[model samples]
Target chain A: MISFQHNRREFLKSSIGLAGLTLPTFLKARAESVGSRIPHKAKSCIIVYTWGGMSHYESFDPKPEAPADIRGPFGNIPTKTPGIRFCEYLPKLAHHSEQLAIVRSVHHKHGGHQQGMYINLTGKDPVGGIKAKSRKNWPSITSMISRFHNPTVGTPAAIRMPYSMYDNGTMMAGEGAGWLGSKYDPILLRTPAGKPYAGVNRYNDRELKLERNIEKRRVTDRLGLLDQLDNSLSHTINGSTPYERLDHYGQMAADMLLGSPVRRAYELEQEDPRIREMYGDHIGGQTLLLSRRLVEAGVPVVQALCSASDLAGGSGDNWDTHRDHFPKMKNRLLPVFDKSVSALLTDLEMRGMLEETLVVFLTDFGRTPKVNNNGGRDHHPGVYSLAFAGGGIQGGLTYGSSDRKGVEPGSEACSPADIHATVYNAMGIDHHTELYDQQGRPFQICDGEPLPII
Target chain B: MVGTFNVMEKLYYIFAIVLINSVHPLQAEPEALRDIERLNGIALKLPEGGWEVGFQLRGQKLNDEDMEAVVRLGSIVSLNLRDTQITSAGLAHLKKLSMLRRLHLERTKVDDAGIGHLTNLQKLEYLNLYGTKVSDEALEHLGQLHRLRKLYLWQTLVTQKGVNKLKNINPKLDISLGIDLTTIVVTNQKSEAKKKTEDLPQLEWLPEEGAKRPPDRSYTGSFIMVYFENNRSKPVKLYWINYNGEQTYYANIDAGQRREQTSYSRAVWLVTDLQEKRLGYFVTDQNTSRAKIPLE
Candidate 1:
C-alpha cells in the first residue's frame, strides 16, 4: 500500500512535469538564429500582458467538443466576418484570427505562475534564486531586446504603460530584468486620470511610491549639484554598482520626465477620442490601446499589464485560477481582453505598423482540462495556448494540436523559451547570442527554437 | 527552452549543481570565499543530525522557497555564507526557522543588532568569522548561544587564538573544524545514456575484409558526444575506417583459430563495465567508426 501510494504521487507530479518537456525544437531553432538574424525582419514588439493568466478554453482555443465541465458554461461564436470560432466573451479578437497565429502547444518546466514567468521572461529556468519573490528578478525579453537592439531611434527602447505591478507587496517574479541589469528596465509610465480613464487601486498607490523615490532622487541630484558636491560614492555603493550599467537609467528616467516622444508614448488621450472609446474605457482596453501609441512613438517594446482585479482580486492579476474560472472568464476576463487585443491588432494593421510590430498575447500558463468541486480550474501548465499575430509571422494559422482529451499536446510541444526565441527571431535579435553576467562568463540568452511559426 | 541541459534538470531536480560566485562578478577576485572557486557541478552527501540553517547573500536570487524544501527534508545544522547578495531585509524570514544552529554571515549585510535576534538558536555549533561587520564588542550578545562550540574569527579584528581562550571556558564544549565539498563526479546511468560509443549492437564483416593483418586497421573514439542507444544481444562484427575509407571489422570472440596466412579481419575492443544500464564494446580500432561486438 505504501509503494502504491508513492507511485500515485509520482504519477501526479510527473503529469505536471511532462507537460513542460515538449518544445526543444523551438528553443534550438531560435538559438540557431542568434548570430544570423541580426539584419532581419521585425523591428519592434508589443506585449499584451494579461496580468493574470487567461482561460484558453474561453478565448482563443475553445474545446467545444469537450465535456460540459471542461468546456465551462460559455458557448462559441463566429468572429468578425468568418468561420473562425471564439468564446462568445472574446468577440472582438475572433474576427482577427486570420491575422493571428495561435500555438496551443506552448508550455514549460514549471507550471506555477512565477516559474512560468521566469521561463517566459528570461527564456531559462529558475537558475539560482529564492522563490519568495523579490525586486531583484531577472529581466524581461523586451529588456533584453532593448538592451541588444536599443530603440528604433534614441527614445529609450522599452516602455511599460499605466504601471508595473507587484503582487501583495512582494515583487512579482519575472517582471523586472533579472540578470540583464538595470540599463534595460522599461520606462514605466505613470498613468494620468480621466475618461477611458486610467485605473488605480491599492497597486497604483504602490506605483506612486516608486514615483516618489524617483522624484526624491532628482531633488537630491539637483541640490548636490548646486552645492558643488559629489554624492557619486553614495550612489555607487548603495545601488550595488559604482555607477556602471545603472548610470544610463538615471539619464533615461530624466529624459522621460522632461518630455519627448517618450513622454507622449503612453498618452492615449492624444489619440482621437472616438478610437479610444472604440477600444473601451476599461483598464485593460485602454492599456492595450496605450501600448500601440508607444509603438507608434518608436518605442521598440511596450508591455501593458491588465489587472487580475479586472476579473477577481485575490488570485492576483495572475491567471492561476484554482476556482471560479468559468464565471470569471465568461463574465469579466474574456470580454475585456478580447475587445482590447482585437482593437490593438486592427488599429496597428490598419495603420500598417503591423508589419514592423510584433503583437503577442501571453500568460503564465493555461488552466486544467477538468474542473474541481470548487467550480473552477486549477493551474494547468500541461496544455495551454498562446497567440501571436503580425510582425513577419504567417496569419490565420494555428500551429500544433493538443490531444482529443486536451491533456497534452498531440502535435508539436513547445517550451516558453521557444516562444521567447521566436520573438527574438522576429525582432532580429540573435536568440543564441550569449549574455555575460557581471562576470565575463557567457550564458546563452535562450536555448529554445523559434516555434516553427515562421 | 528545449535543450539537453533543460531536459536533464527537469528529469531530476534533486541534484545540487548550483553555481555561486561573488555577487560582484566584475571584481578581479571575489572579496571572500576565494578558496571556494566552483561548486556548479559538485554533488554532496548531506549529513544528518542537528537543526539550523542561516545565510546572507543579499541581492542574489536565493530561491528562498527551495530552502523550505531543504529544511523540510531534515534538520539543517550549519550554514557557511560569505560575500553574497542576500541582504538584511531577507534576514527577517530566516528567523522563522528556529532550528538554526551555526549561522555564517561573513561579509553579509547583517548588522550587529541582527545577530542579537539569533540568540534564540541555542543549538548553533560554530559561527563563522568575518562574514559580517560585527565587532568583538558584539561577542557579548552572542554569549546567548551557550551551546556554541567554536567561533571562527578569521580576517576579523577578533584575535583568533584569543576567541579560542574565551570559547574554552565551556568545560563540556568540544570545538571542531568545518568542511564543505572537495570533489564530486556526476554521471548519468547507462539506461539513461543513449548512443554510447563504448557499448553497442554488433555488425559482422570479418571474412568480408580479409586483411589477415591487424596492422592494417584501427578505431578512433570520438572526443565529442560518444553514446548511442541500441537493443540487441547477439555476437556481431564492428568496424573502423580511416580517412581513406579503408575499413576493418572485429568480433572479439572468434570461433576458430587465427588466420595467420590468410588476409583476415582483426578486432580491438572498447573497455566497459557492462553492469546493467551499460553495454561494453569489443576490440575498438583507433582509426574508424566505434561499433559494438558481442561480449562472448
Candidate 2:
C-alpha cells in the first residue's frame, strides 16, 4: 500500500513551507461528515468510465518490441513501479503509478459498442441478444449499490454526471437501474454545456431548484394532488409499471427542490479558485471535479464519463480512434486524460479522502493490437487494461498481464465481472450477495471472484 | 570620288555600332529582387551592396513561397517574416543568405528542425522566434550564432537548460524567454481586501485531535501559472515556485519586464529580492491563471 506519511514527508522536504495554510471549508466538511455513515468500507466510489475503448497499446499495455505498425507512434515512459511503464503522453500519471493497481489482462467477449458498455456497466451479460437500452437489462453496479444504501437526505444514492452514454443514436443499456426499477437508478447530474475549457460552473447554479415564487407549502400540496391523480391512473392503467419512472422523477424533483445538501455541495465557486484551476476548466476536468464534489456531499457512487474536450460539448470523437488515431489520441485524448485523471488522484490523496474513496478507471474494451489500414486500431475484446486505487487498495502492483503482443490475456486473466467484484469488495459488498429482481426472481450481484486487492 | 568614299565609311561605322550593341550582355535585376517584389515586399539596396528585405509595415502577407526569393539575395543582410505563414521548410531558403544579420520568424511554424537551416547565418545579430515550436534541441544550432545580440523565445518549447547552454556560448546575447504578460492585472490583495463574499459554515471546519490532519491547506487541482511583473525601474531577481513545488531562482525580470510559469497547483510562491532575501509568499488562487506579482 502507498503510505500517505511517506508522501507527506516527501512533499514537505521537496517543497516550500506551508505558511498561513488556512484549510478549505469544503475539505474540512468532507473529512468530518464522510465518515459519519458506517455501513460500507468505503464512503464513496468514483468510477472513471472511458466510455469508448482506450487503446491498450497506446496506454497501459505497450508492446515496444512489436513491429512498427503494431507498436504505433508513441513510446513508453517509466512509472514509479520498477518494472512497469505507461505511454509517453501520460507522464503526469506515471508519477502516481505507485498509488495505482493496473490490471492489464482484463478481457471480455463483446466487441460491439453497446454490448461492451452493457457488460462493463452491469458486470453481467444482456438477457437477450445485444440491442438498445431496455428495462429488461440488469441494474448497473452503481444502481445495485444504490439499492442497498439510503443516501443522506437531499442527495442522491448514486449519480452519473455530465451525460449518459449513447452509441450512434441509441441510448446504451446497463447505465441505469434496469430490472431493479427506476427508484434505484443512479440519478443523472446535469452540467450546462459551457465553453470547452471554462472548467466547471458553480455547482449551486446547476442544481434543479423550484421556480421563482413557488412556495414550499404550495409545492407539497401539488405533490399530494399529483399522488392522488397517479393513484387513480394506476388503477385505470392496471399498475404503476407505466408510470414507475414518473414516480421516481417526482420524488427526485421534490428531493432536489424541497431541501437537500446537494445545492450547497454543488457550490464549486466556494472552492478555492486555485483548486478549480488545478482541476482545469475543461469538460473532462470539470466533470471529475463535479464527481469529487458529489462524493464529498455524501453521494455513495459517481460514474464520470471521460470524453475528449472537443466531444465534451456533446458531439465529436471519443477514445474510439477509427482514423487519424495517433494524432487524436496524442493531441486530443491522452493529454486531457493524463492531466485530469492524475489531478483527480492527487486531489483525492491530498484531501485525506483517498482511503475512503474508491477510484476506479475502466473502459468498454481494448483496441486491436495491430494497426489498421487507416493507422488506427479497431475494437478488440481479447484483452485490455483496467485500474483501481484507494479504498484500501494495494498500490504499485499489477494484478494480471497481457501476452507479449498484448493480443490476449497471458496470466491471471480477469474479466469485467472480476473488476466489478473488486469494486464491490472495496465497498464492503459481497460478490455472491443475492437480491431479488422486480419479478421476484433472485439474481447475484456479481458472479466473478474479487481479486485480493487490499 | 570624295562623296562616295564618305558614304562607304558611314555605312561601315553603322554596321560596326550594331555589332557592338548585340555583343553586350542584358543587365537584368537579381531574381531575388523580383521575388521579393512579387509579394509587395520592400527591399532597400544597401550602400555596401547588401540587400535589406522586409514586408511593408503592417503588411504581414509574405509567406514561404516568398522566402525562396531570398536565396537569390547573396548579400541579404536582414529578412523579416513576422506573423507570416513561413514554416520550417522555408528556413532552407535562408541557408544561402549567409550574410544575414537579422531574421524575424515570430509567430511562425519554425520548430527545432527549422532552426538548423539558420546555422550558416554567422553574422546574425538579432533572431526572433517568439510563438514558434522551437524546443531545447534547437539551441545546439543557435550556439554558432555568436554575434546574436537579441533572441526572443517567448511561448516556445525551449527549457532552462537550453537557455543556459546558449548563454554559455554567447554570453552577450540577451534572451527574452517565457510568456509576455503585461496585460494581466493584479487585483487581489488578501491582506487589504475584505472578503467579498462570506463563506458558509462547513461541518468539517476544524480538525479533531491526533487524526493526522493534512497541513492546513488551501486550493485544488494539478497546476497553475504565476506571473512575475517587475514594476521597478531596474532589473531585479525574483524567486518563484517550480513544477515540483520547490522555491528556487526563477528569473530576473528586467525593468518593466514580465515572466510567467505553470507550476503545480497550491504551491506557495516565495518571491525573493535581488539579494536572495525573502519576499512575502503569496498563495496561488484559481480565478486567474496569471498570478500577477508586481515586484515593488
Interface root mean square deviation per prediction? 35.8, 36.1
Estimate, for each residue in B11-106, the C-alpha lDDT of model 1 and write its tens digit. Answer: 433211111121113232221121111121101112233322222211123433433333332334455444444454445455554666656665
TM-score of chain A of 1: 0.79
Q: Candidate 1: which docking quality band?
A: incorrect
What are the lDDT figures for the candidates, one per model? 0.52, 0.65
Q: Which window of ten consecutive residues has the lowest lDDT sum in model 2 chain A?
A: A15-24
lDDT of 1 by residue, A14-65 (tens): 3222322211211212222333445444657988776546667777777788
Off by over 4 Å in 2: A1-40, A129-133, A197-254, A308-315, B1-296
| Top TM-score model | 2
Could you tell me the lDDT of residue A124 within candidate 1? 71
Q: For candidate 2, lDDT tens digit of each residue in A177-295? A: 88887678776665432225221222321223222323465456545644564445424233433333433443354345443445555666766555555665567777788788777
